[model samples]
Target: MAKFRLLPDEQLARSPFKQLWREFSRQHSAIAGLLIFSLFFLLVLLSAVLTPHDPYLQNDSLLLLPPSWSQQGLVQYPFGTDDLGRDLFSRLLVGARYTFGIAMITVMGALVMGLLLGTLAGMTKGLKSSVLNHLLDLALTIPSLLLAIIIVAILGPGLQNTTWAIMLALLPQFVHGIRNAIAEQLNQDYVIAYRLDGANNWQVFSRIILPNIWEKLTLMATMALSTATLDIAALGFLGLGAQAPTAEWGAMIADSLDLIYIAPVSVAIPGLLIFLAVLSVNLVGDGLRNAAKKRREN
Candidate 1:
C-alpha cells in the first residue's frame, strides 16, 4: 500500500485574492490604470470633504480665472473657475462621482440581464436558441449610440434614465459574449460527464456552466464599464445626460465649450479625465483576461 500525506488547506487551495493581486501587480499598464482609477475614486469619495468650495456656488467676479499656479490666480481655485464662477476643481471631483456611478450601474444591470438571458438561450438550444440568437443579431446590427439616443429621448434626461439607456446599449454585447461562453462550456467534457452522472439540466448549468464562464463574463463587464463611460460622456455632450447643476464631467465639458478659446483647460480637464478613465478600464480588463488565461494554462 502506498502512503499518502495530506496537504495543508493553504497548499491545497491558494488564496485567489492574493493571486489576483499578484497578477494585477505584474502588468505595468494595468497598475498605472488602476492607480489612476483609484485616484479618481478617491477624489469622488472625498469631493465634499476635500473640495475648497461649493461646486454650484458662483462668483461672477472670479469667472474664467486661470489655474492656481498661473501668475495672478488664487490658491482657492486649483483648476480654476468656470464661466459661471463655480469652482472647476470641485465640479471635476463631483463629476467623477456621477461618471463612475452611471458606468457602474449600467454595466452591472447589463451584465445581470445578459447573463441570465444568454445562459437560458445557450442551455436550451434548438428553436429557443435560434430565436434568441436572431434577436441578438438584430440588436447587434443596430448602432449602440443611436439606440441609446433613442432610448434616452423617449425616457427624457436624468441620471437614472441615462444609466438605463447605457444599459440597453451595452446589453447586446454582454448577451452575445455570455451566450458564446456558455455554448462553449456545454461542449466541455466536464459537462458531458455531469450529464452522464444523471445531473439535471438546471444543476449542470448552474453548477458547471456558470462557474466555467464567470471569468469571461467578468472581463466583459470591465469592458462594458469603459464603453458606458464613453457613451455617457457622448450623451452629455449632446445635452441629453446628467443635466445642469449636477457637475457631471460630460456636462462640465458641454457647459464650458463656449469658453474653450479663453479657458481651454476647463474643457481639457474633463476631457483628459474621461480619456484616462476609459483607458484605465480597458487596460485593467485586458490585464484580467490575460491573467485568467495564464491561470488556466498553469
Candidate 2:
C-alpha cells in the first residue's frame, strides 16, 4: 500500500488581522505616525479629565507667560498662556477634539456622496457616464482651498458651513476614484458572470461590486480624512473656520502667532498636534495601500 500523507490545514494560513499587523509592523514611519496620532486622539478624548484648568478660563495675571525654561518662568502654565491667559495645554487638548471632529464629519459626508455618484456613473454607460465624468472634471479642476473659500464666503463662516465646504471640496476626487475602480471591475469575468445570472443592478452592486471595491474605498477615505483635517486647520488659521475661543488647533495657532517669541510653546503645541494628526492619516493610508498590494499579489 502506498503511504498516505495528510494535506496541510487551510485554517493554518495567515489571518487577515495577522497579515495586516505584520505588514504594518515593518513600516516604521507608519508605526511612528500611529503613535503620534494616538497620543493626540487620547488627549482630545480625555480633555475634560486631563486638562489642568478650564480651557476658556482667563487669568489676566498670567497672560503671555513664557515657557518653563524661560528666565521669567516656571510659571503655573505648563505650555505657557495664550494672549488671553488660557492654558495652552488645555486649549491644545480641546483643539484636537475640534480638528478631529470636523475632519471625521467632512470625510464621512464626502464618502457617502462620492460612493453613490460614482456607483451610478460607473455602472451606467453612454449619457449618464458622460454627464458625471464632465461634472467631476469641472469640480476637480477647481482648487479645493479656493473652492472652499468661495463657498464659505457665500454661506458665511460657521461649523456647519465649514463642514459643507470641506465635503464639496473633497467629493469630486473620491467620485472619480470610485468610478474608475468600479469601471475596471465591471470588465472582470466574475462581474460579467453575475450579470448574466439575471441579477439586478442593485443586487450586483451591493453583493459583488461593493465588497471588491472596499479596499480602494478605505484608502480613499483615509486620504480624504487627512486632507479634510488639513483644510479645516487652514481655514481656522485664515479666520474662516471654528472662530475665536473655539479651541480649534488652527485658530489656536493663529491666536498664538503674535506671542511666538514671548511664548513659543503656545504656538508649538497646536502646530504639533496638527502636524501629527495629518501625518498619522497619511501613514495609515500608505500602510493600507501596501497591505492591499500584498494581498492582491498573494
Candidate 3:
C-alpha cells in the first residue's frame, strides 16, 4: 500500500524547489525541454541588445532581401529583410518578448485569482463548497480556446484584452484542480490531527494544505503557460492579438500571409519559434506530471 510521507520540517525546509528539480532531472526529454526553453528565454531576454538591426527600422531599398546564404541575400541581414525592409532576425527576436511576456502575465494573473477562489472552495464545507464546485464545473463545460475567443470578441481586440481573455479562460481549470487537491489534503491524517489539536482552519490551510499542493500548482502553471502562449498566437494570427507594427509571433505570421509565396521565411520563422516554444513548455509540464505520478505511486 502507498503511504503518505510528509517529511519532517527540517528536511522540507532545506530546498524544496531544488528537490522538485532533482526529480525533473531524471527525465531526459524534460531536461532537453528545459535546456531548449532556457536558451530561448535567454535569447528573448537579449533580443534587443544582441541583434544588429532595430526591429522597427525599415526601408524600401532593402525590401525582400533573402537570408544571407542565398545568392540574392544581403550580408548585413542574416535572416533576411521583410517586404517592408524590416530585419527579420531582429523582428523575430523582438517578437519573443511579446509572445513570452504576455503568456507569463496571463498565467500568473489567472493562477493568483484561481488559487484564492479554489482555496476558499476547498476549505469550506457543505453548501459553500458545493456551490463553488458547481460554478466551476459549469465554467469548465466551455472549451478553453472557444471561451477565450468569446471573451476576446466581447472585450474587443488587442494584446492586453487578448491576455485577459486567456487568463479568464484558464481560471476554471485551476479552480477545479486546486479545489480537489485541497479537499484530498483536508482528509489526510495530518489535517485531522491539526483539527484535533485545535488548529484553526486558516492555520492548517496556510501551513499544511498550501505547501503540500505546491508541486501540483507548479505543474498547472507550466501547462497553463503553454496554453496561454498558444492561445495568444492563435488570437494574434486572427488579428485579434497584438496590433500591427508590434513584433509578436502571431502578428508576424499574420503580416507574412501576403508574402507567403514571395518570402516563405517570413511565415516560417515565426511559426517555427511558436512551435518550439509550445513544445518545450509542454515537455516540461509532462515531466512535472510524471514526477507527481511517481511521488504518488511511492
Candidate 4:
C-alpha cells in the first residue's frame, strides 16, 4: 500500500482560484459590491415570490400612494404605487429580471462571439487581420450607446430586439479588447519559445494564451456587463426598449415622470436601483482590476 503524507500549511500550494479568491476578499469595496450583486441576483431569482402585489396589476384606488412608512401610505403598497397604480416595489423587483437578465445575456453572447473572432484575428496576420482591425476601429469610433440606438432604430423597439441591438453594439469592443490582449501575449518571448518547440496555434492558444488572458477577459466582461445594464435602462427610458406593461426599471421611471412632483419616490426608487446596479458592478470591476494587478506584481 502506498502511503500519502499531507503537506504542512507553509508547504501546501494554493490553487490559482484560491489565490484569486484570497486577493479578491481583501478588497472592501469589492466585497460590498459582491454583496449588493448577490442581493440583486437573488431578487432576480425570487421576484415572483418576493413581490407582495402583481407588478402589472392596476388598482385605481391605490394610484400614486406613498411609501408604507408615510402617514398616508397603506401597508399593502409598500414602496408605494406608480402613476398607473402598479406596485412600485413589485415592478422594481421584477425589473431586476429584465435589466440584469438582459445585460447578462448580452454580455455572455458578446463574450463568446468576441473570443472566437478575436482569437481568429489575433492568430492571423497580413491583410486579413488588418481588415478586421480596421472594421473594429470604425465600430469603436461610434459610441456603444449611440450604436445601440441606431441598431434599435432599425430593428424596431422591444425587449428581444433591444437585446440583439445591445449585443451587436457591444461585440466590436469585446473583439477589439480581446484581440489586442491576445496579440500582446503572442508577441511575448514565451510564445516564440513555444512555437519554436513545435507548439501549434491551437496548442499555444489553448494552453498558454488563454490562461494568460483570462484575467483581462474577466475584467472586460465585468465592465461590459455594467455598460450593458446602463444601455438597457437608457433604451427603456427613451421608450425604445422593454415597452409598456413591463416592470422594467427604466420604463417604470418613464411612466412616473408626470408624477415626479406628486410622488417623487416612484421616480427616485427605480433611478436609485439603476444607479446602485451600475455602481456595484463598477466597484467590483475596480476591485478585480486592483486584485489582478497585485497578483501579477507578486
Best-performing candidate as measured by TM-score = 4
Scored by lDDT, model 1 comes in at 0.86
Model 2 weakest 10-residue run by lDDT? 6-15
For all predicted structures, in order, the TM-scores are: 0.91, 0.91, 0.91, 0.94
Write the residue-wise lDDT of candidate 4 on 145-245 in tens digits.
Answer: 99999999999999999999999999998999999999999999999999999999999999999999999999999999999999999999999999998
- Better candidate by lDDT, 1 or 2: 1
Put down candidate 1 lDDT per residue, 48-158, tens digits, no spaces. Answer: 788778989999899899999999788989988988899998888888888976787888999999988888778885898899999999999887788899999999988
lDDT tens readout by residue for model 2, 1-298? 8997644333323355465566677888878877876786686678779887899999889888777777876556677777777787778777777888678878888999999999988999898789989989998999888888888999999767888998999989989999999999889999899989998899988999898898899899988888899999999999998888899999888887987877778788788778879889899889878977776665
RMSD after CA superposition, every candidate: 2.7, 2.8, 4.8, 2.2
Residue 94 local lDDT, model 4: 92
Return the TM-score for candidate 4, rounded to 2 decimals: 0.94
Q: List the residue pairs that clash in candidate 4.
A: none
Residue 153, candidate 1: Cα error in Å is 2.1
lDDT for each residue of candidate 3 in 1-298, tens digit (9 for 90 to 100): 9998667644534766655566678999999999988977887788889878988988989999999999998888998998889999999888888897778888999999999999999888899888888989999999888899999999999988998899999999999989999989999998999999999989998999998998889999999989888999999999988998999999999989999999999999899999999999999999988877765553
Clashing pairs in 1: none
Cα TM-score of candidate 2: 0.91
lDDT of each: 0.86, 0.83, 0.89, 0.90
